[model samples]
Structure formats: C-alpha cells, structure tokens
Target: MTTTFESAAKNIIGAGNRLDTLGLAPATAGNYSMRLADGSIAITVSGAHKGLLEKKDIMRVDASGQPLEDKKPSAETLLHTVLYEQYPEANAILHSHSVPLVVLTNYHSREKFYHLEGYELLKVFPGIKTHDVRVSVPVFDNTQDMEDLGEQVRAVLKDRPASSAFMIRAHGLYGWGRTMNEAAQVVEALEVLLSCELETLKLKKR
Candidate 1:
C-alpha cells in the first residue's frame, strides 16, 4: 500500500493545492510528505511555495529526514521524521502555518496544553468515536533549533498516546495519518476546529 515516487509527488502537489485553496497554506509556510514504496520519504523541498508546487519541488529523503536527492528537504523535516518514527501507521504528515492557528496560539497564555472538546469533528481523529471526548493539543514555543523543537515535540507527545496532532505556538499545526488522504483530512479537520475556537473567542469578546 506504499506509494511510488511519482504518486507521492503528485499527492504532495495536489495536497499543496488543496491546502492553499482552503487558505491553510500561505506563501511558503507549509510542508507535505508521503512515505514511498522503498520506505523513503518524498517531501516538499525547502523554500518552495506550497500553493504552486511542481514535481521538481518534491524531493526524496531518508527516514531520518536526510536528503536523498540534490534538493534540500524542508527545514522542519525532523518533525515529520520524528512522527513517522514514533507512529508506524503514519504514512504522511502535513504542517501548515494557518492564520487561525497562529493567532490562537499566540494570543493564549503560555500553558501546558490546550483542550479541544465536545466537537463532532473530533471523530475525524483516530480512536475517538463520540463528540463527548476531549483531546489535548500541545503547543510549544517556537524555536529556531529543529533538533530541540523535535525533541520537545517528542517529549510532549509521549504523554498523550491518543494525540493525532499538535500546534507550534505562534507558528502552525502539524497533522498526520495512515495515508496521504487521511492526513489531509486530519489537517483540514484541525484547521476547522481552530477556526471554530477563534470564532468562539470573538463571540466571548462581544
């Protein structure tokens, strides 16, 4: 069920377009990836515009996120690799710096974690079947050090066995799933939830 290089590249391109259309990806602010048939990862190249991605914008990388092709992998490749390493079933990862996520995380006081609860969309995540469940989306302070950031993410994730996604304070959200399509769905659902949370805050201010 692993994807081919060409298939992965196409998926990345299509995913970029879809995310862009949804306004989840602006400028060069997002990265996409898929696990290839050979166990390698096909990911968007660093500095490439997600909305207008081409096949050449996608490059191959090792499971450790090392560049297997001439092009450099995304700067947050380690984040993607760490998730893939931790979750054997995760075949794709998508990271997006959306307005709602950025604003929400930035405005919230620095806290241990944020709770998302009572949303029907919660079912979009794995394991949960009811809207009554609660999920914590850990938000970490933004760091220039990918290794340090990745390690922090790993530590936070270790505490939540059922977490499907997380957010980077003042940055964006990261989502993954068993397949590229499922990963896209997870990202979309998270984005919608974040948007809803933002709107709720607006109503509270009224």
Candidate 2:
C-alpha cells in the first residue's frame, strides 16, 4: 500500500506538470486522484498549486472520500470518490479547470449538454471507432454544496456511457481512466475539444 501510494503520488505530480504547462491547472484550481491497491485513493490535498505539487501534497481517502489522515482532501473529493465507486476499473480521475471548458459551458448556459461530433479528434476517447458520430458531454450546474453538486453529477452521468468526461457549467471538467496516463490523455483531448468548440462559436457569430 505504501508503494502504491508513493507511485500514485509521483504520477499525479507528473500529470500536474503536464497539465500546468497546457494552462489547465491555473492557480490551485484542480484536483487529481488514483485508486490505491488497498481500495483507498491518493488525492491532491486542498490549496496546493497543481503545478508545484509534491509527493507530500498527496493524501489518502477511502473509496467514499473520507480522509484517512489529518491532511485535508480537495473539496471535490466526493467527486473523485464517486467516479471510483461508479466504475470499479477506473483507477485514476482528474478534474481540470481550463478556460475553454468554462467559457464554452457558460456560453451554452441553457443547454444541458455540449456536443463534440464529426471531428477526427473524437477518436481520442475510448470506444470511438470513428468520428462519424457525436458524443455528448454533460454540462452540470455549479454550486458550493459538494454533496448537492455530487448528486447532480451522479444523475447526469447515470445513463450516459461510463467514464467519459463531464463538465460543470462555468466551472470545469472531470474525466477518469483505467490508468494515470489514459486519464491525462482524456483531459488533454477534452481540453482541446472544448477549445475547438469555443472557436467554432466565435466563427458562427461572425
């Protein structure tokens, strides 16, 4: 378990560096986690800039998001925990705050979902054999109440395909994968897809 925690922590730190370089985790705005061998999760503690994350910044929480130690977990701890519970095979989860997702989600404030279809980049997600179809990314309302927010997320994601990314209106996005590398890939792909959608909106307005 100790080794699992250490390895997960290092992977998170590396992911933070990559995400930081892409301007995904600005300030202290995102959280990341990996499911440990013992069924607990190693997550980034609250208030640390992801770009500067160290192994010490990672802490443990149960599968239900209960803190295992004195250190505080991210406010979105429940969010990550829920994903783990929802998908037993998903070992890693990421929540990134990027401008493109925020802007695009808010731009379609009344719309409950964002559609990214017919793009070759759609292949970036798993099970996408081709770009001939559209994938709907859920856009949820944001709130300070974590539990309330979590329930909302649960409902929205319940019927859709499991483990694809979901967004919070004017907030950010959450994605999970079987491994840290795949989770990071999901984040990067969604980030770029959101940016492309936002750019298209600008073009349509012209």
Which pairs of residues collide in model 1?
none
TM-score of each: 0.96, 0.96
Instruction: List residue ranges in candidate 1 displaced over 4 A.
Output: none
Clashes of each: 0, 0
* TM-score for candidate 1: 0.96
Q: Write the per-residue lDDT of candidate 2 for residues 60-130, one digit (tens) a residue.
A: 99888999999999999998987777777788888899888888777787988888889888887888879
Which candidate number has the best lDDT? 1
Query: What lDDT score goes with residue 149 in model 1?
Result: 92
Could you tell me the lDDT of residue 101 within candidate 2?
84
Predicted structure 1: lDDT: 0.89
lDDT of 1 by residue, 63-161 (tens): 999899789899999999888887777888899888888888888858757789999998999988999998888888998899999999888887676
